[model samples]
Target: MTITVFTNARLLDLQGGTLTAPSAVLVEGDRISGIGATDGFPEGAKVIDLAGKTLMPGLIDCHFHVVAYSLDLWANAIAPDSLAGLRAAKVMSGLLDAGFTTIRDLGGADLGLVRGVEEGLIDGPDLVICGKGLSMTGGHTDLRQRTDVRPRCPWLAPRQHGRSG
Candidate 1:
């Protein structure tokens, strides 16, 4: 088994809700095996010096939007799902870069993005996705021109099917 030790890390103390003293953390594979003062590390373990920097658990973003690239809601609504899905993957990757290990996507993220992240094909946050966002009639996402028409799913607003409510 391969082991990596992160040294000089100021870890967060969950019990006290504070940053703990500089210490060592042992990681075996994907799991953290131990954390303590650097006294007894097994031989052949790779060591990384954190240089007294802070190290803690990755953050979770409760609300994330992987779609809607522009303020023009109608245009975004008309975009092909494949295009939106690709853009969502990029957004998820940006979230990961921002230290969000997990994200709850409010809308427009799909199973493909989740699978990509799981398969390591795309670098992205752990995606917790709601298939799509629905709005009420004349609600926030109803951005149709008077001459436009869209098919209304059961959950979609009346405006989507060209019915004003």
Candidate 2:
């Protein structure tokens, strides 16, 4: 496995509410193998110096709408599926950069996005999704503006068997 060592980091312990002294974290492939002083680094492991930076656990967002690219509901509703997927990818990448490693998308995200994340096609956090949210005809999931009277987006509405209500 590819082994990497991160040194000179102050490990943050949120539960204990403390920061450790300068330490080294050993990572083997995708998993953390060890954490302690520099003496435990495996031979030939690639080393990264944190330079006293804090190494903390990744954060989690319990609720998110990954497919809603913007606050403009009408715009989102009108966006093509390909465009929306691309936008979601960008948002997911930003979340990862901001140290959020896990996110639960309560609405709008689909199985395709989940597969993309799992297969590393998208640079994103571990996404937990419920496919889509339930709403009444004039309720929250309806993205139509008050003045514009258009049929609800078929993709946004939950399907029942072979039909959409």
Candidate 3:
């Protein structure tokens, strides 16, 4: 197995304190093999001289709204067409680029968006979506006013789901 080594780096161990001086890290393909002093490096391994750069694991955002911004939920819910989907894809890409490799979308996202991200149909972060958020009528997210803008009713807002109220 081929091993890639990164040396002369400072590491921030969140569980511990911080690592001072130059350190070394090893990676075998996608997984990290080991991490320690440069003396542990194997012969003929591809060595990267980090030159004292700080190294840490990829960041994760536990809560984020992938589909709609906080203030624009009404607009997004009203028109969740291709345009909205594209917007969501762009937002997800930005999040990933910002070092949030994993994100849990709190609300305003549907199964289709989640599937699109998972299937690599779009460039985006690894998404964990709640599909839709549950809310009470006129309690938190009442979208009765925006009905004229778009025909489809908000699926998550509390109301009569079946035949009766």
Candidate 1 residues lying further than 4 Å off, grouped into runs, are 14-17, 145-165
Query: Considering lDDT, which of the candidate structures 1 and 3 is the better prediction for this target?
Result: 1
Candidate 2's TM-score: 0.78
TM-score of each: 0.77, 0.78, 0.71
* Candidate 3 residue-wise lDDT, 1-165, digit = tens: 778898998888767886767888898877898878787677788999998998777788887787674465678777747877888888988887777777888776678877887898977777777767667765446666534455445874567657863
What are the clashing pairs of model 1? none
Per-residue lDDT over 1-165 for candidate 1, one digit per residue giving the tens place of the 0 to 100 score? 899999989988889998888899999988999999876788999999998899878899888677766777777789998787777677777878888999898877778888989999888889898977888767776676666666766675544556577
Local accuracy by lDDT, each model: 0.83, 0.89, 0.77
Q: Which stretches of candidate 3 lie over 4 Å from their true place?
A: 43-46, 144-165
When summed lDDT is taken over every stretch of 10 residues in candidate 2, the lowest stretch is 137-146
lDDT of 3: 0.77
Instruction: For candidate 2, give the lDDT of residue 112.
Output: 92
